[model samples]
Target chain A: MRSFVALFRKELRSYFGSPPFYFVATAFLAYAGYYFHSDLIYFITFGFGLNIMENFWQILFVDLRLVLIFAVPLLTMRLLAEERRLGTLELLLTYPLRDGAIVAAKLGACLVVVATLLAGTLVYPLLVYHVEPFAFEPLFAAYLGLLLFAGVCASYGLFISSLTDSQVLAGFLTALPLLLLWLLSWNEAAAASGTLPVVRAISLFNHFQPFSVGVIDLRDVFYFLYATGLFVWATLRVLEARQWRGRR
Target chain B: MIRSELLTKYYGSVRAVGGVSFSVGAGEVAALLGPNGAGKSTVMRLLTGYVSPTAGRALVGDVDVAERPVTARRQIGYLPEQVSLYPEFTVRRYLGFVGEVKGLARRRRRAAIGRVIEQCGLGEVADRHNGTLSKGYRQRVGLAQALLGDPAVLVLDEPTVGLDPVQAVEMRELIRTLAGCTVLLSTHNLTEASALCSRVIILSHGSLVAADTAAELGRRLEGAGRLVVRIDGPPDAVAQGLSALPGVLGIERGEPDGQAGVRFVVLASNPEPVQRRLAAMAVAAGWTLLEVQVKPPTLEDLFVRLVGSEP
Candidate 1:
């Protein structure tokens, strides 16, 4: 745990210290904020009912999802690849710490950075309160689902980052998998036929749709957790494999 | 405190390190000597838990490196050859992080970071971003990080490959100061090893050929010493001139050292005759002997001889 703290602080400090970390965080924050609030003032001045808040919440949820998908890869790309390229991974590995702690601390720190950006979007909700304070349940549900979805994305990005020393390669490979998951639900008719149950089950965005609609489905929650676990496990395996290859 | 028994590592079908076995007790410094790709760094990688051995095992303080890696790695500090760091981090935060990961308590962790920063001469740049430092400074940062937490074993690969002469000397002294700290530093710089390490391990093509004290390896590999005589006289004349002198085995002309000079070395089973030939050859041909010096068996000689003999 102490080791994890050390690693976590290093990760957080690294992000705050590097220009890229700030640049990426700021860029995503600006873009996602603007996408959700271009018409926020207009809606508020005219006075909206609960329905307006719901629509805003829905748009905000989508915006949150977009942030999770794109911003996470940027953050994770350098987590392992840059360390490997710089060869500091050797120095870090030699420390009296476990590989999981290293991975978790880094991954956790990035999630916090992303969460901070997501937290920045709270301004929109406060704006909604001027017209309607609205219900807490649905909004909280959507946010929770967004977090679950982001955890899965971040873990997958960390996995991709572990596989290569090139940040660009890690970023592109991570995006490739994410793009498929994001767009996978588009073929709903194919999923409906039941022939591609496995394919549909693998699509994260499809599972996320239940939460986006404000329904707390256990199956979807289970699926997201499972996806997160799968990627975390894969990342661990990849790190272990790297050692074997590096030794010989 | 550290030991390896027949540790071998393979990458797909390619073998990077094979059948290496060596041990270092606490307060001892073992130097791994080899040319590039000679598996010196690979061995460090295995012992430090950066990479796992494909076969056999590495034990650091009785903790099997692969099976209980986290526990084992906690006892080791590694300075990789690349000397890379988190460019944005200050030396303090970086080492603080490293100390934390090593499981030090907060107060002790801070103390350790401060000590290492001072020890590695990083005090001047403790707050500077790692990316902004010079190569020498970056290497110092790498060294500083490796020193964090003062683990039971320290594994450094080519730790001084890029420092200037003065800095290299300082680095050597620092490594020696760490004598009581169990250490394994690898380098192609034989002089560095002689000046710093107590034991030298020679690796050629991933195999351990000889491991001994610096002087012992030198004496065992090529024996006492010999001299290379490069002269302006004809090759045959130089050869004939030095031939049959007591303790002289023979003479052979080497490739041209320059257009005007024919270079040849004399192999004497003993050192005395080589010294005698230096004077005799200088007078015999008025040959403008460009360079005539007796060379002793050094770690470099041992490295070259062992590597040259590898099949």
Candidate 2:
């Protein structure tokens, strides 16, 4: 447990020390802020209501998800890949650490970085409330949804990062799967009746839809948790496989 | 207390490290001497638990590295050949991180970091970023990290590969100060090995060709000391006379040493009497005897002989 904390602290320090964290953070905030302003304009033009907060939460959640698809990959591309490239992965393995602890530390630290970026978007909602007041319940649910989605994306990106030593390749490969999932739900309404439900079930955006509308569905929550677990597990396996290969 | 028995590793079909084994007692400094690709690094990796042996076992103290890597790693401090470091981390921060990961108590961590900073002569660069330091300083940082928790065994791979002559000497001196530390350093530098390590283990083509104290390996590999006699006499007659001397085993002609004397390398198990006899023969023949120097076997000679004899 101490090692985990130590590794976590190291991970966090590394993130803040590098330029990529600030670069991705700045880009995420700028992109989300632009969409937030546009969402605010639409909200003002459309006027406020009991449903205004729900719509606002949905817009914020969707824009945040879009920003994360790019941001998370950039943020996580170096989690393991950079370590491997720098040959520090071998050094880390020599430490008295369970591979799982190393993976968990990286995941935990990256989640914090992502959460900070998401937290910056909180100002948008606070600003909206001054001009047009709304309930907090839906906003809470939507933020929870965003956190879950970002963790899932971050884990997926981490898994990709563990697959190679090239940060560029990790980013590219991570974006590929995320874009596919995002596109799957994009045209869900026009999909064939037979495949529409299945497509929506697997689509990341669809899992966040209930929270966006102020309804906390257990099934959607479980899906994100399970997906995050799956990716984190996969990342651990990749790390273990690296050991097996390195031993030879 | 480090040992490996018949340790072997193969990357697919290419054997990186063949069945090789050696042990270093507690507080003893042993060197893994070999050429590039001769498995010095691989052997270090195996003992340090950076990798597992495919065919054999490594024991750090009583812990089996393959069976209990974490516990075994706890007893070992490793500095790989590359000296990998986080570029953005200052020397102090990096050492602190290593201390934390090694599970040192807060007070101990701070004290150990301080001690190592002084030990490795890294006081000046403690606040400097790792990437900004010179190669010699960077290697020092790597050494400092390895020394952080004061583990039972220190495994260093080519600890002085890229340093200038002065820095290399200083690095050797620094390692020498670790008098009671069990060190297993792999290096291609024979002088470094002879200067710092009491025991030398030579690896060639992934197999340990020899392992012994430097003096013993030198004497054993290069059988006998020889005397080089520079005599101003006819080559054939000088060779015949040198061969007939009571202590002379054989004599081989050498190029003249610019002073107009044909040189002969007289091989003899005992060079003391042979040197005296050759001088007397040159005097009896009225030939000028310029030089008769006995050349003792050296670690350099042993290294070249052993490494060259490999198929």
Candidate 3:
């Protein structure tokens, strides 16, 4: 537990001490904030009889997810890749800590950064609330969904990062599959009618849609958790394999 | 405090470390001397629990590294050859992180960090970022990281590879001050091994070729001292006379002395007697004795002879 905390704190420090974290956070907030402003104007002008907060937040959450698809990879690419490239991973593995602890600490740190970025988007909700009050349940559900989605993305990104020492390559590889999953349901003609439902079922977009509408389904939550676990497990395996395969 | 029983590691078909075994008693300093790719780093990695051996076991302080890696690692402080550090972290913060990973309590971590900082002479640059420090300071910081938690075993791989002369000496001095710690450090430098280690383990082709004190290895391998004699006489006549002298095992022609003299290397069990006899023979033969110097076998000589003879 102590080793985990120490590694967690160190990962946090590395995130805050470097330029990429600030760059990604700033870019994500700016992009999310710009869409939130435009979505607010669209809500004010065209939204009638609709719950302004629900519709506004749902749109904003979707926009933030889009930005995160790209931003999260940038954030997670260096987590393991940089360590391997710098030869610090060997030093880290030698410490009195389990490989799982190391992986959890890094993923935890990345989640914290992602959560902070999601927190920045709260200003949009606060601004909307002053004009008209709204239910907080859906808003909370939406934020949870976004955090879970980002967590899934981060786990996969970390797993990819563990495969190579090139951060750019890791980022590119992570984004490619995530982008495909997000776009899986977009093309109705790409799949046969019988296969379309199965494709939509696995799409990250379809799973996150229920949360946007203020619905917290256990299946969606479980799906995100299971995917995150799958990739986290894969990463642990890669780390363990280094001992047998020999660390470069 | 540290032992490896037939520890072997294979990276696919290529064997990085064969079935090799050695032990270092508590409070002893041993040196792993080998040329590049002799499995020195691999052996250290196996002992530190950074990598598992394919066969046999590594033990640190009664704990098997493969069975209880974290527990075994808790008793080891390792400094790898490439001193990798987070460039953004200050030396103090880095050491603090290392202490934390070592499971030191907060207050104890602070004390250990401070002690290592003082011990490694890192107080001057404690607040400086690691990337901005010089190579010497980086090496010192790596050592300081290893010194934290005061582990029973210290495995340092090429601890002073890139440092300047002064920094290397300072690093050696710092390592020398680590009393009561079983230290196993690897180096290509025989001088470093001779200076800092009481026992030298020489590896050739991933196998232990020799493991003993430097002086003992010399005595066992070479058996006697060597003498270099320069005489102003016929080369063949000088060689014939030197080979006939008592106590001389063999004689070989050495490089010319630039002056009008021939040089010959005389291998003898007892060099003082051979030196005197050669000088007397030079005088009797009316040959001027240019120089006659006894050359004690160094770790380098033993290392070269051992490593060079490996298939």
Show the lowest summed lDDT stretch of 10 residues, model 1 chain B: B302-311
Across residues A92-206, which tens digit of lDDT does each residue of candidate 2 receive?
9989998889999999999999888888888987876787666777888888888899889999999999989999999999999898778777766667899888877788898
Model 3 pairs whose backbones collide: none
User: What's the fnat for candidate 3, on a 0 to 1 scale?
Assistant: 0.84
Please identify which of the two predictions, 1 or 2, would achieve the higher DockQ against the true structure: 1
Query: Which TM-score values does chain B get in all models?
Result: 0.83, 0.80, 0.82
Candidate with better lDDT, 1 vs 2: 2
lDDT of candidate 1 at residue B198, scale 0 to 100: 82
lDDT per residue as tens, model 3, A1-248: 99999999888888888887888888998899899888878877888558754667778788888999999999999999999999999999999999999999999999999998889888877876787777777889889999999989999999999999999999999999888767665666877899888888777888998888778999999999998999999999999887768765
Docking outcome class, model 2: medium
Steric clash pairs (candidate 2): none
**Total backbone collisions, model 3:** 0
Per-residue error for B268 in candidate 2, Å, reads: 9.4
Against the hidden true structure, what lDDT does model 1 obtain? 0.77
- lDDT-better candidate, 1 vs 3: 3
Error of 3 at A233 (Å): 1.4
lDDT order of candidates, top first: 3, 2, 1
Candidates in descending DockQ order: 3, 1, 2
- State the TM-score for model 1: 0.85
The Cα error of candidate 3 at residue A76, in Å, is 0.6
